[model samples]
Structure formats: structure tokens, C-alpha cells
Target: MNQQPVEGFSKLSKQRKIDWLIKEYLSDDRSYEQILQQYWNGDAILQKLHEEFSENTISNFYMPYGIAPNFLIDGKLLALPMAVEESSVVAAASKAAKFWIDKGGFKTTIINTKKLGHTHFIINVEPHKLQHFFNFKLKKRLFEATEEITKNMRNRGGGILNIRLIDKTADLENYFQLKASFDTVDSMGANFINSCLEQFGKTLTEEVAKDETFTPEEKDSLQIVMNILSNFTPDCIVRAEVSCKIEDLKDDSGISNEEFATKFKRAVTIAEIEPFRATTHNKGIMNGVDAVVIATGNDFRATEACAHAYAAKDGKYTSLTHCTIDGGVFRFWIDLPISVGVVGGLTNLHPLVKFSLALLGKPSAQELMSILAVSGLAQNFAAIRSLVTTGIQKGHMKMHLLNILNQLGATEEEKNHFVTYFKDKTVTHHEVISQFNSLRAQ
Candidate 1:
């Protein structure tokens, strides 16, 4: 469809944008206007606050916020809040949490907590000279120059940790990188790290211009390309694990414990060896990770990017998790580079986010990383257990039945009837419509 740009779309009032959208796209359908209003907050103050969250606010989008309790991580029981619209994700995590609670639950360890940023520049100078320029004296001077920016972060026990010069001339002529590491403490630190990088870029340019060691060509060639924090934080990593004896792996799937363990391990092996399978495997893990991350008002996009990148760090895409049965003990675990924050962003501003953090006992950044990793591990375990046993559709379809019923506009009575009707039957959209039609006919 051909469309014309609406000038000053963002400057329009909230209602004005809605009116424009309805006129242009809805063809003057008044029903959508009501639908949009239906999701608005009942309180005027809350609704106004929500409108300010973004530009051109039309309506509030909502996802089911659920809690998965009995997560005994590091001897602490926690009820993790998860915001997701997927049918079976919360159910799967809850089931895994209960199953592992008796099996010593989950153990988590923080491997590293340093975030990364880069300052890319081009300098037509010898590699030795470039290396010498980033020497101890200059590095100290650079850190000192950013003291004004780093002062607050340092007071909070987080600041610029290290600055190193990286030679990338092999890829592009005269290309070099000024890579930095930071301890952001409790915050996600995107803005802080970027601010520091910009300051560093300015300092580098000024310092090079003043140095008598560089010719005009070398000084002029020092052009900063960009300064930004990297979402691929390999150094910010955590590990979560759950282990139990192979003989203890019993369930209603009718598979023997030993056979189940063997099959589970095999499924993980396939994900490890096959990129196609690994992608979906990792996505299942993210279902749990992202839910908790979003619930706590953290950046799920950055967390997901870092995780997928870490999965491919071995030069081939593979699962973010691993499983093994050794000495009659079955163990499933994941080592992932997950960067999340307990403070900053929407954690304090959003009401639901604050509630979710409070529900988590207000963990530190490191503790939040552990909780998120465990959530992913739990979700992966539940998914693989289903995949190797009764197949994923049985339980998923059962949970998805409500969505189908709701879509058909089934009455509460009819929905109640079908809920029991499809308990042991496979659910399909066609079957649901057929049943709804049959019920209506009667």
C-alpha cells in the first residue's frame, strides 16, 4: 500500500496520533479506538505516566506476569517473576524448579563481571609506535583525564578498569582499537561506559596532537571512528547447574530412568553438533531468561545478543547449555555471558518492575545474573525432557487451548467445558473451531 509520511508525527499529542492512525490505517473503524482504550490503566495518573514512557503512545501492551517459585539457588529459595505471552514457558520453568528442588536445586557461580567498550580509530603510524603511545604513562594519563566522568562510578565501587590498544590493521589499513573494560557494579552501565569512551576518544585525540613523537601525518591520521559499549560481554559470565543421580530420573513418561538420561544427553549432543538445532535450543533457553529479564526491567535484547554470541564463540553455533551422565549421575548445566542490572533503567521507575525486584529479594547484579542463568537452565531442562519423552505438543497444546478458546470468543461456560474436553486430546485450531461450532449449534 502506498503511504505518505505524516510530518511532525512525534510532536502530535497522544490522542492526535491515535486519531491519525485510525484515519489512515483503520479506515475510520471506531472499534479499534475502543480496543486501544480498553488496555489503558484505570487510574488517570498511571495512564498519564504510561503515556510518557514513549512517543506516540496509543495503548498499553501487556503480557502475562507469572511467578515460578521454589527456585532454591545457592541455598536461597526465590520466587522468580516472569513476564511472557508464550503458553508453556512459565509452566515449564515452574515444573523444572520443583523437580530440581528436591534434587539439590540449582547452584550458581559468577565467573566474571567486567563489561566492555571500544574506541575505534585509524592512525597511519608504525605498530610499535602505536603500542608505545598506549604505554603505562599514557594509559594512566588517559584514566586521569576521565576522572570527572568516572568519579561517581568510582564512588560506587565501579569505574574504568583497564584500557588496552588492539591492532586491527590486518582487516583494514591503519585500523586500531582502544578497548576498555569496566566494572559497572549494580547498573547495566551502557550510558556510563559510552560516556567514558567518548571522553577517552577526546583525550586520545588531544594527547596525540600534543605529542612531539608523532609526525603531522600520524597525528592527522588519528581519526576516531566510533565509541560505544559492546553488548557482547564475554567477560560478564555466570554458570548454573543441577545434578541428580541417573536412577532418580523418574517420571510419568514411561521411559526408564537410565534410558531417559541417555536420551536427554543425546538431545543436548545434537544441539551441540548442529547449528540449526542449536538456534532453537538456545531460543528455548532465552524464553526463560528473557521473561525474568523483562520482568525485572533489564535489557533482554542485550542479554540475548551476548548469549547467542557466546554460543558461537567456539567458531560454530551450539547450545548455550550442556548435559552429561557420568558415574550414574546426570547433570545439566549452562555457562553463559549474561549482563543484567538490579538498579537503573526501568527497575526503579516502573511500578511492576519494582515489585518484581522486591519479589526477588532485591538481589545484587551478580545475584541477578545467577538467578537469570538458573532460569534459563531450568527452562532448557523442561524443554529437553519434553522433547525426548512425550513430545513438546502434548503439554504445550494443553496450555495453548485457552488462547484458542479466547480467540473463538467462547463463553465462559463453553471454555470451561472444552478445558476438560481437551485434557487428553490433541488441540488444533480447526478442532477448536469445530467444537465451538458444535457447541453453538446445540
Candidate 2:
């Protein structure tokens, strides 16, 4: 039976917390306690930093940090850092990168980099009057109020792009918005944008209270519901593509490059039109995207939420990747709505995250967006090619071979023998176990 919940869990020392956890939940197992201690960092300062990253701290959870090399993006060769536990992701990305390098490699264009936020409020007022007051009376004051906060951003060539007073009374009673856009430059700008928005919220309340146009009731009825930034950056888009002569593609699955192009295009089209397939299709793309995002210490959850939302922005969930073949040339691309930073949050703190940024040659936010979009495109191509040709299971199961060997407690000699033995053989959990048992008995 589970023990009752304890209060002030956060207040407990790390050791005490571990003690309580083991006693209450782990049956006081010293082995489980040792597992946690073994994962702790050797450096006290670094461990303290990790502890402070979240509340109710525990030992660090580790993920394999793998490299996807030979990525020639926009003519520069880079080996991307991908952090994921999934067995085949890094291998697939590397294979795709090498395949495209001989072709044109990955090319990208930054369409826009505008991010937005809203100060949501409720106000019972005449719509036309409210709009009129915003136009002549309150607009200048809003900008003036945030000048100090935005001064540094403006000096850096990025600041408030625009602000508008939106009317949404048709959807809900007394609901409206102060929608504003920003250019945050090289950082993700979540904090900067939110700070500006909070100021907007305060300025709105103060201005409304003091303005003669609002009247007493209008002033009192105005309620600032929230001041927050939106992760849905629809306008922030980057396009990454790989194009090559159809004949340049190498297919060993008994299919011509021409046939491969047609089938691959068809697969992509199905994802674009069908919701069910699109979900899994985009998930595969994110298998590459989220890995890079996490490795660089960016927020994969925010990145994922924005991407999935962008996929369905047309009112239906669909693929973020596309494919085309025209005039003897095959092209694959993804217009990914991804926003990432290279100079803030964990970028400045985590050691491995700093290494990832350095390994990518310290990309700006826009450049990082291009890299991320290209990663997704590369992964989608690899997946589609497999689905249309040899099948996803063959390579995936082969990658699972190592995990299986570990699970069956195979010795080093047995592992080496089985790895060679399975070079041309199909790998399944049962088959591995059976083969290992047979080898051991012999």
C-alpha cells in the first residue's frame, strides 16, 4: 500500500526527501537509493544548479546525446546534436543527411520572425466608442508607457512591431484584446515579451481609470484577465528544402528513383489530406525536431505545442512536411513554425546545452530555426522512403538489437557474435532470446 502524501515536500533536504520517498514508496530499498545517488553530479555547484532548475528536486535523468553528422545545411557542413532515448532517430537522421549532401543539401529561407502576445481584458462599453478612444486617445500612451522597457530591445534593432485593439464582443460578452507583435532577435524572447505585455496590462488599467471617455462604470467594469505571451507563432516561419535530380537518389529496394518519387509524393499527400495519418506523420518529424530542441536546452514542450497547433492552424491537423517531383527533380521540404533561442535559459547554464550550441557554431535564433526545420524535413524523408520501400521495421528492429542484448544479460562475446550474426537477419525480441539461449546451451 502507498503511504499518505507528505506536506512541505519541497522544504525537505535532498537526502531527507530521498529517504521519505524510499520509505513510503520504495519499501526502504537501499538499491533504489543508490541508483539516485549514483546519478548525482560530482561537482557540487553544477548539481546545485540542476536542483534549482526545478522545485522538489531529485537526481538527474539522463538521455543519450548522439550526433547526426554530415548535415550540409545552406552549404555549411554541421554535425547536429540530438538528445533522445529512441534507438533509431540519430541513425536515420545521419543517413538522410549523408544522402542529401551529394545533392543540393538543405536550403532554408526565413519567412518572418514576428512573435505576438495579448493582454486579455473584459470591458462593457460601446464598440465604436472603444475603438475611437483607442485610435486617438490611448494608442500613443500605450507606446509611451512601454518606452523604458522596450528601449534596449529597440536599440538592438528589435522591439514592438505593432499593436492593435481587437473587438471580440460577438464571441463573448465584454471580451476584447490588446494584441501586440514583437521582434525578439536572437533570443526566444518569452521573458521580454511577457514583461512588455505586463506593462501593457497595467498601462491599460491605469489609462482607462483616468480617461474621461470611459465614464465611471466603464472604468470599474474593465478587468485585466491576463497578460501572457503566445507560443503559437504562426507568422514566425522557416522553410527548409532538399532538392536533387531524381536519378541521383540511391534506392536498394528494387524500385527506380522515379517510382520512389511518385510513391513518396503520394505518401506526403495522404498526410496533408488525412488527419489520422498526419498525426503519426508529424510525430515522426518531431522525433527529429524535439530531439535537437531538447539537446540545446530549449523547451521541447513549447516547441511541440506550437508545432502541433501550427499543423492544425488551417482547422484540420495535417503534416508539416511536403514532397514534390517535377521535371526530373525531386524536392522535399518542411515549413516549420519553430522558435528557439541560443543565448538564454539553459543555454547560459547547462554544460551540455552550451556544448550543443557551440557544436552548431552558435546559430542565431533564425539560423537555429532553419536548422530545426531542416532536421524535421530530413527525418520525414527518411521515414517516407522507408515506408514506400523496404519497410520501417527492418532498420528499427536492427537498432533494437543492442537493447535486447542488454536485457537478456548477454556477455560481451555473445553480443559481438550476435551483432555480426544479425547483420542480414531479422531481429525480434523473441528471436534474440531464443538465439541467445541456443548459443548459451551450445
Candidate 3:
């Protein structure tokens, strides 16, 4: 394939970049530019703000920002803001929330709030000497060096909690790490943690050079590789759970309450033991998680990486959610490990992010964590409930009806007709198109 490269693309103006794209790759079709411009913010200042959010911005891409109401978490009712492109996610969450609310609503607990970062380096030294030095001399220096960067965080009752020197010479000769734990409180703290880690690297090099206990060659042997914060925050966890008597599980499924509970547990067990099933099961869970995460302007990519890693932490891929039936009560829950922020980054700049935070009642980071976990749990319940009864497509395809209708170029009157026709019928792309074409013939 021949690839086209642009010269000084980032330096190009918005209009010029679109022109270049049309002339070079879009067959010089001006309609493409019009389509891109259609999504751009009408306000000049807001459009400029969006452009600077990323580099080489040609135009804006839009996702439907939806709200799922009736979420009762820890005795608090919340209407979650979700930004997603996929169909049926918000509807599923809302339906699940309403179902659980009738029983007693969802409950959540904050297990911990500790995030992690590391300073990776290699130093030629005996293990004992490095350990003794880190304990007696270098450890205090690391804290003192990062005081400036962590001052505001500490004032907020969150900051660097602990640091230690870890030797990994057995795995790789002279490879070591300074593993640190943090309490970032309300912010995702990537920048804050990375800033402190970089300072630690700087302090480690500077202090080692000044110490007379180390020989010149030993000092020179110290090489700092990098300082970074890990997205996989296993220790920072929140648990969301819902429980109800089996009798309450009785619904329109036509199955006995006991039978519904049994099948739901069995479906979860399949996902737990089967890798092929677990992948799709977890994707359904993230349909809820990533939506809320994106709506709040947090990093969905990081959240996904961490959640999947945690799922496979036991050396096999499995489900993030769990379920059990005991003493005639059915319980379902998920202990999700994720770090999010109610402030900073895009929360401070993006208008919708700010609006989302407010819509969520301006929750603290801990509250937000619980909300996200509950979103995932609620979505999973809705999925399993559907799967064990009417099947996944019944609801998903119905929600997807509009997309099919639009693709077939149905008018508003036809749309209303088809929607009513498909209300009690199966909705498939082929069937929808076929029915519309027959209507056109009539």
C-alpha cells in the first residue's frame, strides 16, 4: 500500500488541514469537509478550546451523552452520566437500577485508596548496602525532595504515603525499583505521581553522588532508567453489591424465582471458567464502566488496562463480577479497582466534564469510584438477567432498531410505522430492510 505523509501537518490551520485531506485522499470531494464541519462547536471560543485539547485537530467527534437514573448506591440515589456510542448500554443500566431499587438498592464500600508508582534504576551494589542506605539515608531524602510537588496534595489530606527500595538483581543483574504507594484522594494523580517520581529519580542521583560511603565507580554505576506511575491500581479498590430474596427475583421471565437465580449463577460460573466467554462478559461490564468514565473525562484506556490486568492477576482470564445464592437470598457484586478524579485534567477544562461532575452531585473521588463500580455491576446484572431469560439480542436488537431504519433511508412516517411493527417482533437488520422495501412496493 502506498502511504501519503504530510509535511508540517501539525502546523497547518484547521481549514488548510481539511483541504489537504480532501485534495490528497478524499478524491477532492468538498462534501467531506462539510460533514466534518457540521460536528464542530458553533461557538468560536469553545471550538478553539476543543482544538487545543489535542494536536492536529481537523474536527470534533461526538458521542451521545446520556443519563441513567435511579441508581441507589450506599443509600444515595444517583443519576449517572454516560458518554457512549454503542446502543442499549444506558437503557440496560437504568432498567437494572430500577429493578434493584425495588429490592433495597445497591450498596458499595471503599476497600482502599492507595495508588502505585515506581522509580526504575540499575546500580552496582551489594543488596545489604543498598537496603541499609535506603532505610537510613536515602528514604528521607526522597520525601523531602518531593515536598514541593506534593505540598498541595498533602494539604488535601492525600500525598505520598510510603516508599521503599526493592532489589531485583536476581531477575536482572543490578536492576532495582523504588516502589511507592500514594493517597491521591480526589484526582487520578498521574501527573502528580509522575512529577514526584521524576523528582525521586533526580534526588536519588544527586544524593548518591554526594554520599562518601560509596566509591566513585559505585556512584557512577547508578543509572536511572525511568520514573512512571502504573495504571494497574490493584490496591485502590471499591466493592458494589446487591442482594435480595429469591422471591423478589420473580418477574415476567415465566421461570420460578429459584430457577432464575440458579441459571444466573450458572451463567456467571461459565464466564469464570471459560476464557472465551469471559472476554465478552467483561466487555458488557465495561460498556457501563467506560461510558461513565468517559463522561467524567477520565481515561477509559487506563481504566480498561487496569481492570483486564486485575481480571488476569490469578494467571487466568476470568470475570470481574461474582454471584452467589445463599439462605434464599441472591447476591451479585464486583470489587473493581480503578482510580479516578473529580478534579484536574479535562475536568477543569471541558464544559461537559464539569457538567457531568455536577450531575453526579460533585462526588469526591471515593464516591465516584463507588459509582463506577456500581455502574459495572448494574450493567452485568442486566446482561446476565437477559441472557438467562429472553436472550441478549431481544433488548440489544430492539435498541438497535433506529440505526437499521436510518440505514434503509426510511422517512419519519415509515420509522414510526416500523417501530410500532417491531415492538412485539424480532428486529434484525435484514428483516427491517426487507419489511421497509415491501412497504415501499405497496
Candidate 4:
């Protein structure tokens, strides 16, 4: 529980300062709210974002991860905000972000704000009578249901903006589709839309009672199969931009910054239009976002689904994040559908979430969103950094050596020796044993 900052970090930039402080000290600090307030000029941003939105319907999740200090992304300091659970995500992001920070912080811009609408229902219509059920009442029932769903949303800043009916069948088939656009404020509106569908399904069944064309047996035979939540959560949208300087892309690999950026851009290009490549491309972004997701206890599954879906939402598989070098600066951007929250559900129940939120001092959804954007960019850099300079195995192996040594109950001297040996790129059990023996002899 040392309050002292990481040694030599004073020479780091402001973004580095925040990164080191959060990574090392936050685990011990009782609250990050104080740190964010003391450093980032208070939680004013959080206040503003929440002031414009309602928490009653939406929840926001926030995770503060360390973005290595001294980052110069497009010549800007990036306070990378990551929402993910796995370790090394923030570290990877920070490493990548730092690579760009020296040139200029990752130049990122958001694209649009879209939302998903979910509906759950229970129907009571005869199986055979279903053929005669297509009427104006069905359309009316949907409108009425959408109106109800949009009622509170409109008042609070969101409403049913649009509705679409997709037909899964054109002929005498039982499957039908009813989709509505409800502007859910801030968070994913799965709960809200489902409630609306429950009512609509019941009303539709009741309306069938008045149909003279259907006999009593027909009406009795009708029943609702799956009046549950709909998966057509194709509503949210996101976009970002980041750029790095050519001079700052340097590493020990000796690849000139420009050359490296070119190679990295080529890799990114290959990732585009290739599902095999795009999956890894998007995985890097998720590394950052998922960290915050686990930190805040949101539904990581749903968030991930929407993200991948968004990547190919246009019917073509492609990278959600884009990287390039423009005007002598390396640029990175990611557009993803991230439906997460900072309040509600387990954001309060989970112990780590509350602790992380307290450490963050309560950030606004937009601020949190911005931070997530940076994390995505940073993660992209990390992958490219590994490919362009040091192979991915080098640093990872060194880190893993420490864990392995710890697991083996090696003494501090023995562990340090193993770490040094591994860093030298000589990773063999024999070498590890030799070092351990030498340490014991000493």
C-alpha cells in the first residue's frame, strides 16, 4: 500500500502519471474519486454526462486502466479509459497508446449514437388460424405497443424512433417479425422493450377473439411460443479516430517510424475485408473494452456480440478499428457498438466494480466512452508494435517467466535470475535450473 509514485515516472508525461498512479496505487487506494478529482479537475465531466441523461433507464460501467505514461499519440496525451476484465489489456493498450503518444495521441472521432430495441412476448392464437391473422389490427397493435414503449423514453430523452417489420416467411409459415426502434437513454434498453412486447403479445391475442373468421377451436388452438426477448439489437453505433507521428513509432527493432507505420497500416489493411484478420483486429479493441466491462460487471457477452455484429453490420466483414498514417502522423480509429453502463444491476453489487468506480471518482458515460475509445486504439498499437518490432513472444515470455518462477516457489534471487535469463531470450528449463542452482550456491 505505498502511496509513493513509481520511481522515474516523474519524467513521464501527464497521461503516464495517471497510468502509473492507477495501475500501482489504485489497488491500495480506498477511492479513485479523490484521485480523479485531484488530478482531472474533479468529476465535472461525469456530472455533465449524467445531467443530460437519466440513470433510471440506463447504466454506465467505468474501468480505469493504466496507459503507460509518456504517450504521444498524434502529439497528444491520452487518458485511456478501458472497460475489460483480463489482465494485460490495459497494459497492452497503454503500451500501444504510448507508441502513438510520442507522435500525437491517437486521433479519434466518434461516429454516431445508435440504440437497440428488445421485445419479449407471449401469444395465444391457434396454430391453424394463424394464416388468417394478417390484418390491420396487427399493425395497429404494433404501433400501440411502440407508443407505450416510447412514452417514457421520449420524456427522458429517447423514444421509439422507428419500427421495422421483417418477414422470416412469405408464405403459409408461422414465423413473423416485428421490430421497433425505442430510443433507450444512455444504456441498453433490453428490459424496456421486452416489457412493451409482453403487453403487445397479450393484446394481440385478445384482439384475435373478435375475429369472426376464426372458429372457437381455432382461437383455442392458438398459443404464444416464444414471447421472450428479441435478438435484433441492431441499434447502437460507434466510431473513432487516432493518429501518430512518424518519428515516434521507433522501437528497438530498427524499423524507421514511417516504415513501421506503413507495415502496421498494411497489416491493418489486410485485416479489413477478411473475417480471419478482422477477428483479431477487433479482438485488440475488445482487449481494452472488455477490461472495463469486467471492472464494471456489465454483460460482457452482450457488449461483445454487439461489437462483432457492428463490425459486419453492413453485411461485409471488416475491421471495426482503422489505422493509417496521414500527414506524417499515425492515425487509429474504432467504431463499435458498446452498450454498457456505469450504474444499476451489479455495478453496485460487485465489490470490485464499486471499488473501481470509487477509484475512478465516478466518470460520465461519455468520458468513460472516450476512455474506451483510447483503449481500443492503444490495443491496436500493441498488436502492431509487437508485429513491427519485437516479436510478441519476447516480452510476454519474460512476464510469464516471473509467474512460472513464482509458481515454482523460487526465492527472490532465483526469480530475478530467471527473469534476467528469460529477457536474454534463453528460455530453457535447464537454464532456469542452472540459475537456481547458482543462486543456491551463492
Candidate 5:
């Protein structure tokens, strides 16, 4: 059982009490009509997008959406946070973070973003002569031709910084691919890199024409080919750190908390090396991250891919976050690619997304990442607490009662009774149905 704040609940009228329960538990402030609009309009748009991109199979992207509470992002209060469901994720992170917050708040630092550009060039020539074509002369010419491509970005407070070349390699037997990376500042690098490639392709064609060092036949052999975007971005990084003490984890449980901490550390360490373990390990981190990503309307898939890739970047699967215990304080640090944007995409179109962003007080990209990292740590706390104590099912089942109440169309009185019944561990759909029937008989 949980104690209700006397002034908070007792002073509220019946309707106010119900409204508060709905707001806090459901994390939705929309009226009945507005809620209806979300499901109805959302279903329609999803259907259309699904049909249009039938081959794309957007439905494969389904993940349960839930909200995290008690979060302050960059000093701004936020309620009704959104997150995707993965088992033990929310509980672990939330609890982990709350432990730290009990001592002192988690602190974060973010680096300025340098956008990445992908330039794809497809050239057809003799496979044996490929090595001859990749000379220093060609590298200098490529750089000089693309120099003017930075003009527009420089004008708008962004500029091209650097580029790197990549070679074709065989993957899974006989597939060959070419890619290159470039850095753009401020602007998303796709358009900028594409523009550079378009101009460079022209330059290469003109160079081939002027080079009389080769016969027309030999010139035909040197095909200046397709140039396009690569996934390479310049240097930009974000860093975050959190600290907490074991005293913060003390709960009603009389079990050995110190023993639990030692065990928990070993478990987290296991998550570092094994790919199978790393998936669930990082999933916990993303529980908090995906919510902010969805709320801000940035691309979640890109964020997910980059994060997971970064986790395994050093030729070993490791935790994207680090954990340690120092004296009395437990410390955590996480650094990952959080390439998220504040403006653009479905976030600009969806009504609820707009409302959610407004609820957040319109945070900047850096502030958003900082808070998100905090939430990830918090959620990690929530998970470990459950694993160490009474197990995850208990609290989750308690919270899940609200969903059951909604399903039964329970009235205010019924909702109170429903929650009480849940506390007794006897609540069931059958019991709820019987209670409904009994009330009807009344």
C-alpha cells in the first residue's frame, strides 16, 4: 500500500481526485474528444503510410509506448514522458537514477553536433587498374573540386570540414560497395554532400576530357561515374555523468543491500562483453531515450542504430554506459551518438507530438540529450531495484491495474475499489466482472 498525501488527495473533490489519477497514471491531459482524435487520426495516417510504403513494412517497427515520470530536463519540469517498452528496462533505469538523485542530481555535458555527409561514387573501370586510379593526384583533385560546395553552408553558419575515402569490399561472398564520409556543420549533411557530389561529378567529366595523356580509347576506359552521400559525419560527441550513494537504495526491504550491490555490479559487467546480453543491457538505456526521441519528433531508428553500433564499435560488444562505485557514491557515465533534431518530420505534423513537445517547454537538442541520459540512468535504477528486491512483476502488475480499470469502464468509486483489490493481490478480470455485475444488480 502507498500513503496518499493528506492535503493532496483529501482536499480534492471526487471528480478532481479521478482527474488527478487519470493525469498521473495515464500521463494524458487530452479530453475524451482529444483522445479520440489521437487514436482515430493516428490510425488513419498509419494506414495510409502503411499502404504507400507496403514494402517498407512500418508495422515491423511496433513497440509499446509508455511514459516516465518525475523527470527534470535541464532545469525544466516535464510530465507525461513517452518511452518504448522493453522488459525490465524502465524499472531498472528509473530506479538506478532515483538512487543517484537521492544523493545529488545527475550532471551531463553535450558537444556541438557536426553533421555527417555520405558521398557515394560509382565508377566502372578495369578491376586490376582500380589501384592506379586511387592516387594522391585524384585525392587532391577531389578535394579542390568540392571546395566551393562549402559556400552555402558557410553562409548559413555551417561549413564543410573534411572528407575520407573508402574502398569496395566483398561482403557475404560477391557484393561490392563504395562509401565516403564528410562533415557538415549545423545543417543535415545529406543535401550538402549530395550537392557537392553533383558538382564534383561534372568536374571529373571535364578533367577526363582535357587529359590528352590518354588516347580516346584509353579515356573511354576511365569512366568518371556516379557520385552521391555517405554516412560519414565530422566530429561531434555528447557526454554525461551521474553519481549516487548506496544509502539512497534503502527501501522497506530488510535484505542485505550490500550483497545485492555486488551481485548487481557483476550482472552489469556481464552486459558489457556478450552481444546477447548487450542487447537487453542497452535496451534499458533506450527506454528513457526513445521517449524523448519520440516526444521531440526526431528519427528514433537512426538514434537506435547509431547507439547500438557505437556500443559494438570497438570490435567488442560492450555497455554503452559505464558504472562504478566510489567511496559512498555510485557513478555512471554514458557517451553515444544521439543525433536528434528539434525541428522537422512527423513531430511537426502530429497534434499529440506538438502537445508533448510543448509540455516539455521546447528543449534544445543538447538539453534534450542530457535529460534523456538522466532518464536512461533513472530507468536503469528502476530495473536493478526490482531485480535486487521483490522482482519486476510486482510493481508492473500494480501499475497495470489502471489498464484493467480502464477496460472495465470502472466509475470513480469502482476505480478506488479496484486499486484496493489490487493491493490485496486478488484482483482479476473475473472478479472485476463479478463486481460490475453485482453493482448492476444494485
Candidate 6:
């Protein structure tokens, strides 16, 4: 491998960068160049827009944008778009949607929609003195100072909800946090919350400088570390659940409904107590969550980080969802904190996102939260049901059969024949390749 660095790489034209990359690293491979070109949108304008989505854009990387229809969420049918490369995710979600639709659908409720931001600072002043200064008068003044920044949000009935002082001397010397909560309404409010916090930080610095109760040394010790919004939004939570009679859970797998529910509940309990299981357990939940989040043009990374942080909020990693059978009814639900927005970022910029929102009837932020949470819950149920019944691979590997066939370069006839052949038999990569090779020999 050559270790030489290419100077002015970012300044190179798009084609130049592509040329340089191919010549430098790919040994001038035209096939790889063609592969990149093959995925570019035929429309030049759209392709350019995609290229500009980020810097040094050589080409577009794509995931299959699929639709999982028949989601009966909150008494409405929705077709959710999922952007994922995995084989069985969309299939499993679709199965879950269809199963739950006949079981009275998924019910969801938004517990709250308040996002959080903080202005972290260190102060050498007495704790009591700082608390007294953060009283009603100072708090009101702080809110008033950010009025310009929050005016539009305020007019829309969303703005700074509360501000409080948190003492952290036990954790660090002279450390304190000005925790602020906001109602961003339909937008994720990252920029809005950050702007407000920065303004608050400036106001706090000025106010502390002028406070007669604070000596010169104390004023100098008051230092702002950072001001930013928190993705771990515990207050912005939603609950989504599905319930049915245990008898209604009967399936073609020959497992009794009672036994099915018991195994499912036990599976959830193991995730709750075991850290290793909980990591993968929550990842399965996010496969559903991140897909919907990406489809709707929300920040999937932020949502993922927040959801996992919420999972470990109890100081031990655990499941984000729970299953229970009560009074002859089998219920599964997830109460997780997910911060998402429907009005900003890529939601407004991407064409597919607009379509995805329209497919969901253009839900508000709270409604989007409910729908996302339900997607996770439904995915979990489908997974647990599969695990407890015929085992995970029966369905997963079946869904994966197409990928194997395609990879083996099976023609349409071979694919159709082998798809039917593998329907009743187990499928593996080696088996598919061997069968394909044998068929080709014939």
C-alpha cells in the first residue's frame, strides 16, 4: 500500500477526485468506475444535488428503500418506508404489521415532547448563592434574553419550558449545569435548542459579572464549558403497545398460544437482566426504528444513540421493550425516549422523505414518535415469536435465499426454480452455490 498523501483532495473537481481515486488506489479499474456510475441518478440535476449532500462526493451509495405496508397504527393504516440493506428486516416488519392488524392494531400515546439542552459551567461561588441567583427573577430574565431567538417557537406554542440549576460538586469541583427544557413541537429542535442555550450562556456570563453578590474572584471563576442539546431526552417519551388474547396468538407453527406467550415473555426478561443479550436485543429493536427514522428523514444516528442511552439509563443495559400476559391478554410494548423531528433537516430537503411523511398522513412530531415506537415494538414481537416457535433462521434464511441466488449469478429460470425448491428446505450459501453450479452443468 502506498502511503503517499494526495494534497488538495477536497479542492479537486468531482471527476478529478474519481480519477485520482481510481488511478491511485484502484489501479485504474474501469469496472469499479462503472459500478459507481451505474448507481448515479439518470437525471443530472438530481445526481448533482446528491453529490453536494456532503463534501468530496464521488458517487452515491444506496440502500434498498422499501415499504412495509399494512401498519395499523393508532387506528390508521400506514405504509412505512424502511431504508435498510438487511434481508429479513422489511419482511419481518411486514409480518408483524399484518399479524397485529388483526389483533386490534397498535395503540400509542405520547407521554411528553419536551427536549433538553444544557449550559455547563464551573463556578467557585457558594452553591446556595448560585441557587439563590437562579431564582424566579433570574430565570425570568434568562428567558427574556433568549426571546428573540425563541420568538418563532414561542408563537407556535413551543419554546423554553423550564430552566434549573444542577449542582455537581460531588462529581467534579465547582461544576454546575444549567439544564433547560424546551418544546420544539414538530421540529427536532437541535438548532433551536443549541441557539437558545448559547444565548443563555452569554446571558449567564454577563449577569454573573454584574451581580453585586459575586466577588471579582468568583466572577472570574465562572466559566462556560459548553452549551448543547441532549439527545438522551428522557422527558420526550412515547408508549406503543399491542394486545391480544393469548388464544389469538395461535400460529401455523404448532406451538400452543400459551406456550408461545410464555417463551416470548421469558425472552424479554432475559434481555432485561443480561447485558450481552440486551445489546443485541436492543439492536434488533433499532433495526426497525432506524429504518423508519431514516425513511422519514429524521436523524437515525441521534435516535439510535438516544434509545441505547435510554436502555442503559438504569446503570445496567436492558431491553427497551417489555412483554406481559395479564388477564388472559398477551401485551407487548415499548416505552422509550426518542427525539425526532418532522419539519427540519433532511425531512424538508429530500423528496422521498416528503413522500414518506405523506404516506403516514403527515404526522406531527408526537405522532411520528408514536409510529416509530410502534415499529420497534412490532419488530420485537415478530422476532420473539419467530424465536420461540420455529426458530429465527427458518424465516430469516428464507428471506435471505434471494440474496444468495443473486450472488451466485442464477438466471431468472434458475432463481424461480430454486426459490420454489428452497421453500420447503433449509437454505445456506454453500448449498445454493452447489445447487446452482450443478444446474448450470446440466
What's each prediction's TM-score? Answer: 0.97, 0.98, 0.97, 0.69, 0.67, 0.97
Each model's total of backbone clashes: 0, 0, 0, 60, 27, 0
Candidate 3 local lDDT, 260-325, one digit each (tens): 999999999999999899999999999999999999999999999999999999999999999999
**Candidate 1, residue 193: how far the Cα is off, in Å:** 0.5
What is the C-alpha lDDT profile of model 4 across 1-442, one tens digit per residue?
6566357754665445555666676774536645454543236565444423432212244434443444443344434334544445666766665555545455444354455443323233443344345444465666675575667677878765654444444343544445556555554566776776666567656766777876787566555544454333454444556554677656667877677778878888988868998898788777767766666556768767777876787898788777767788777677666665666666666556676656555654444455556666667768767876776666555545665666668978776666666665645555666676677778
Q: lDDT winner between 1 and 5, please give it.
A: 1
Give one digit per residue, the lDDT tens place, for model 1 in 1-442: 3456799998888788888888888888889989999999999898988888776788899999999989999999999999999999999999999988888899999999999999999999999987987894568877999899899999999999999999999999999998999999999999999999998899899999999999998898889999999999999999999998987877669989998999999999999999999999999999999999999999999999999999998899999999888899999999989888888888888899999989989999999999999999999999999999999988898899999998888889998999999988988888988988998998
lDDT for model 2, on a 0 to 1 scale?
0.92
Worst 10 residues of 4 by lDDT: 50-59
Scored against the true structure, residue 214 in model 2 reaches a CA lDDT of: 78
In model 4, the runs with Cα more than 4 Å from the true position are 1-87, 102-104, 107-110, 118-152, 170-172, 211-223, 228-234, 245-252, 312-317, 325-329, 358-361, 426-434, 437-442
lDDT-sorted candidate list, best first: 3, 1, 2, 6, 4, 5
lDDT scores in order: 0.92, 0.92, 0.94, 0.60, 0.59, 0.90
Better by lDDT, candidate 5 or 2: 2
List clashing residue pairs in candidate 2: none
lDDT of 3 at 213: 91
Off by over 4 Å in 6: none
TM-score of 1: 0.97
- Give the better candidate number (5 or 6) by TM-score: 6
Task: Report the error of model 6 at residue 269, Å.
Answer: 1.4
**After TM-score superposition, what is the CA distance of residue 62 in candidate 1 from its true location, in Å?**
1.0
